[model samples]
Target: MTMTVRDLRPGVRADFEGFARVRHLALPFYLVTPDSLVYDLAHAHPASHFRPLVAEEDGEIVGTAQVGIVHDSPEPGQGYVNVYVHPERTGRGAGTALVRAAEEHLAGVGATKLFAWVLDEPGNRAFAERHGYRGSRSAHFLRLDLTNGTLPPRPPLPAGVELRTGADFADDPRPVFELDSETMSDEPSDIDYEFTDYEAWLEGTWHHPLFSPELTSIAVADGRPVAFSAARTDGGTRYGTVMTGTARAFRGRGLAKLAKADSLQRAREAGLTEAFTGNDARNGPMIAVNKWFGYEICATEVRYVRELG
Candidate 1:
């Protein structure tokens, strides 16, 4: 069957399920659902120009791509295109068609440099190179079998330090936002971002469909949030930590570790069986922490970049 690519329709149940299914099939560790997909499409910043595209083959979605401009990056012309095709449908034209459509959308929206994440497999690397992208930095996805593996005992909080869940900040999340902004600026990434808009952050992160406030843990000191382990859940057995960071003033004190350990125990007791997280290959401290919690490297993906005229 011939493949055709089109922007995913928001209200259509088929498109919603198809897009999420394709993502789960290609990258099982990713936390996504039909609700989250539609919420992201509706709440993304206008400047981002985000589009979720799908490649359909005989009425079935065989490929998916998330194309967007880096609206928060300090650099204006940077953009990203992440394409994933159904594992069973590889070698077909689905991937190629999805990439072409994504690239065109990004280029037309004033992008000069485009970035993509290609799996570490030989075929995936060759495919990116065939489309003008060159390899850059890489990241690792780690997984823990919560039900079968043993997790370290919850870390004891230091004197004058208290551990709390994200639900504790329901009335006012400004302090948490401040901590998130500071830590985000220090994260390792090719593009530099300025997270100055609180409203935008609330829309994009705090209110997202899958954000599991009860599962997230925060470390409080001096009456404010000093570190946090942000989490998302599939509402059933799967759990993922999106970010675990500590303020510069609180680093080296094991605050981030305490928050994560607390969060993990919460997930396990809540009946979650799988735990997943990603760390940049260059982030040694985080890798060490995850390893301490019994997470093993499950997959690696290389970032590919292309500069256009």
Candidate 2:
């Protein structure tokens, strides 16, 4: 079987569905849909040099890669190439072909350092090592069964604080953007990011096809949002918390937990059966909060880095 690598053809229904299928087979814990795939390709910032590639065997797509530069980071030359092959299609040349295409594209865009997330498995790690990538930090993909599992009761609102939803900010979402910026800056990651562009956030996140405004929960204190849990739902029963964080001054007050709990209950009430979220392994506090909500680690991925000549 001859394996060939090529760019995903935009506006092609089969290509989008095939790409999403490969992603779902490789990473079942995260939500993947054709709409999201197309949306990302259309909305990605030009500076990011985002390119999605697919590896095909015969007439079927077997692997996918999303290669792009970290344009939002203050540091330059950092790029990422996340590759995933169909679980049953491994051992074929699909993965290697996808990686070669991804690395070549990223390097052509002036990437001096490349990063990839490999499943925390022996074979996956070996593949990265063979490709000259060194393992770095790891992350966990956690899942919660909202349909059958019991969620914590919503706690009473602390004095002077009120619970709100992202829908409340429809008229003006600057407050939500501000909260997102602050919390994102404090997130644990190898690449430091600054969310300085409000318009960019609106286009890339707030208006994304999967983002669910009604299920997202926010904590308001002293007339400003101090904590938030952003929600994203596939046009199905699957729901995910994209981000849950509290402001620096609001830490240690259990506000993050409160916000997440509210979002979970809302998701359950809205008929979302499955919930998913991811966390950096080094983020102890958030992991504890997720554990408190009965989220269990379903899968783990290790970050792999390689320096390009």
Tens-place lDDT per residue, model 2, 260-307, is 999999899889999999999999999999998999999999999999
The local distance difference test score of each candidate is: 0.94, 0.94
RMSD from true fold, candidate 1:
0.7
lDDT tens digits, residue span 1-309, model 1: 878999999799889999999999999978999999999998989999999999999989999999999999888999999999999999999999988888888889999999998889999999999999999999999999999998999888899999999999989988999999999999998889999999998998899889988999999999999999999998779999999999999899999999999999999999999999999999999999999999999999999999987
What candidate 1 gets wrong by more than 4 Å, as runs, is none
Q: Report each candidate's C-alpha RMSD, comma-separated, in the order given.
A: 0.7, 0.7
Give every collision pair in model 2: none
- Provide the lDDT at 183 for model 1: 98
Where is the poorest 10-residue window by lDDT in model 2?
147-156
Model 2 vs. true fold: TM:
0.99
Backbone clash count for every predicted candidate, in the order shown: 0, 0
